[model samples]
Target: MELGACPKSMRYGPCGGVRTGGGCEVVDEPCPFVGRPLVEWAGTELAPRAIELPRFLVDHRPTGDDRVDRQVLDDYAASGVAVLLGDHLDDPPAVDRVAAAERTVDAGVPTIATITGRDRSTDERAEMIDGLLAAGVAAVLCVTGDHPSARFTAHPDVTFVSEGTLLAGEVRSRGGRVAVAESPAAEPTRQRAARLVEKQRAGADIAVLNHSGPVADVIAFAEQASALGCRLPMYAPVPVMTDLASMAALEQFPGLTIADDAVNAMHTSSDPFSTGLDLAVAMAGELLGSGSIAGVNLSGVATSGGAVERGRVMRRVVDAVTA
Candidate 1:
């Protein structure tokens, strides 16, 4: 059987190239398979996050089902895109983030683990960093993760610097790439923009624009960043809604921007999932055309379609859009 050109190597397979110092021997491109997925993020990626077993998954799926995880990672990795693993939402961070990342690596998929900083401390950051280093992961996407418990909320009176910033600095010292999330949906105030630049200087190697809304807004955010001189490899997540019901539900969730165009298009379609997929593909094309972001993530929210189907559909969209 014949095979297509491998994007990672940009060469003919059966993938005989030896990666020296973690780069392709032929093209000198970074080894797409080694290290954490985010560090190896090219211009596009399929980011599948790990979430706590929701009430939805509790009855339908078993806890700790690594098979689905491995299969999902493998499918995306084969397409020359890195797999980003997300942190579960729990007090004290219930599951081991490093172990979750290790699963991605084990599937031969590069991955980025989400590191939450709110309601946390520096010492805890040190421990998590140690675990990531031990897990052989190379990149991370750190965020001031939402705080329902307020256990680690950063109060203004306390002069709370984000854990993501500290982790970025530490990751830099270790020679691994670090990513910090950016809120492009918010009005780009000088204060917020300046903080992002400072984050880059402090050791953040890249940016993941928080879940975006309209494509115009996303494009505008990129332009705003350019104007602000925030030059970092960046990616924006493509929000997926499997149905109008799901779309309506997300209205209360700030920053999960659903473009007006997308809503109109999806509302008219008999097949909302397919409509959503098309909208995502179109959004990806525009985002890449802007030449601002290095990639796009499929926010990994539960779609009306099952998680596996949503991811698979997004992988197809990434291939078509990025190609």
Candidate 2:
């Protein structure tokens, strides 16, 4: 009777798991929904979705172009993982793509390049697209890079020149898998729903929901995605601020809610490593159970070590839940 639980009609295999669909059969139970197949609201048949978990990448800037940063990227690629680069780096969007591509050349891990709207010129965008194709970066997360407002000049510097959805479409047309970032509470629920529909319509292959709020909010958001008739993948963010300075910096991000207790707990905890593992397990369980989510996107922090650790945690969680 509970959502995500096994249906009655499905037969169980010898594996001791419920076989709701054709994927595999569980051993010890009768199918709950005997005659009723799990179908999308529009009456479409459902399919098992595989998840892609990549390492989160950060851009490190040192005055001008730095070889050190490139070396750091080499280390990241060695893990056969992807990363997100900061937008502040020179050339912003395209530079990250180029850097990531360079690493992919040697490491063989796919790169999920970030695109910031401001630093990208028409020419740069063209070159970046060419570079991505050449490097074969798996997918691109299109976002309007974060911009500062009114620090000095009367006119503050601007951020993303175009909307993320439109930009994603452009990338997709050019033979790239495009993912766009959206916030559940960037506005009211209705507004978010409308925007999500529009993004799907515009050719976004995946939607990344930054850190989730209440469970109800996430369910509602997933329902909206289903209604939009677009089965694009959804990436959920799980924040990682295991220390005081990091926690403080995270709190400053707009729309982020890091509980004071949670922050302090992470700071003093001796077993933060285990804590992260536990959190990843819980999140992976929920994500896999949903049947709607295609993959898990680890957001918030960016580093080779951080991404590899989280990716390992995710892999463990997936094996547990799916098995």
Candidate 3:
């Protein structure tokens, strides 16, 4: 199968959203790149360059109100946590990511802005990166975003003109720090690390590992990537599930797999919020102590109108881990 067969048009072949049965995430067909050899990076070789960023990172969902967003940035800044400002399919239509990043940076918070190939052309992405860097973002996370699910109403018809591997080099050429994502539990698991190596060669400075399974699995993935000559510092995601709503929201993310034990514990607990918070803290601590990863990303969905509450939960986990 060729790259044209992929709905995302990713030269990197299978993306993180490949189904367990080796099916495409967007179409009713087997993933074309499933059994093929990993596509080697074809871009000019560029060494990964380090950038200063916080050890504790949280996914910030803009509430679409400037005052609320400012207060949230101030809160995270005070807590010594960096905020990842990215465009997700579920983000409110009014949420302007560049403006949000500008506000976060202006507020003296470390901001990692994300750029995806899902809905923008190469020139559009380049311009976006330039705007983000000018706004003083600490780094730019280059990702191949998930295919738009049919459940999203009025989803735009767009093309993925440049995937993360290609975007990494683009970011580097524009003098911006580059962070790329890897899914260890996705199909072609063994090739995942090799893919990271290619990403690093394409100028990725950091790797953010998606929620795969247990902490042990995360560590193993890091080790595998290291053995394959991937030297980029890695950040492991710690799921922030404080309630059933948040848990359900997180489960909607493609290629994410929370351990069954943790899920059961959260479901059976008398106080799910406390149970989930404790579980997140424990997981963060374990990942930090594993000596495999450089940091942890407090990653999950917030219930409707629960962004502030979710931030409090993230703060608690950060405090517990750093204390």
- Candidate 3 lDDT by residue in tens digits, 266-312: 88999887898889999999988889998898998744346676677
Cα lDDT tens digits for candidate 2, 233-269: 7765545443444445545444344434455566678
TM-score of each: 0.69, 0.63, 0.96
Q: How many backbone clashes does candidate 2 have?
A: 14
Better structure of 1 and 3 per TM-score: 3
lDDT of each: 0.54, 0.49, 0.84
What does the lDDT read for residue 280 in candidate 2? 46
Please report the candidate that would top TM-score against the real structure. 3
C-alpha RMSD by candidate, in order: 16.8, 15.1, 1.5
lDDT of 1: 0.54
Per-residue lDDT tens digits for candidate 1, residues 1-113, read 11222232121111112232444332335434333222111222222223211010000111255676556666666665665566534313334667776776676655666
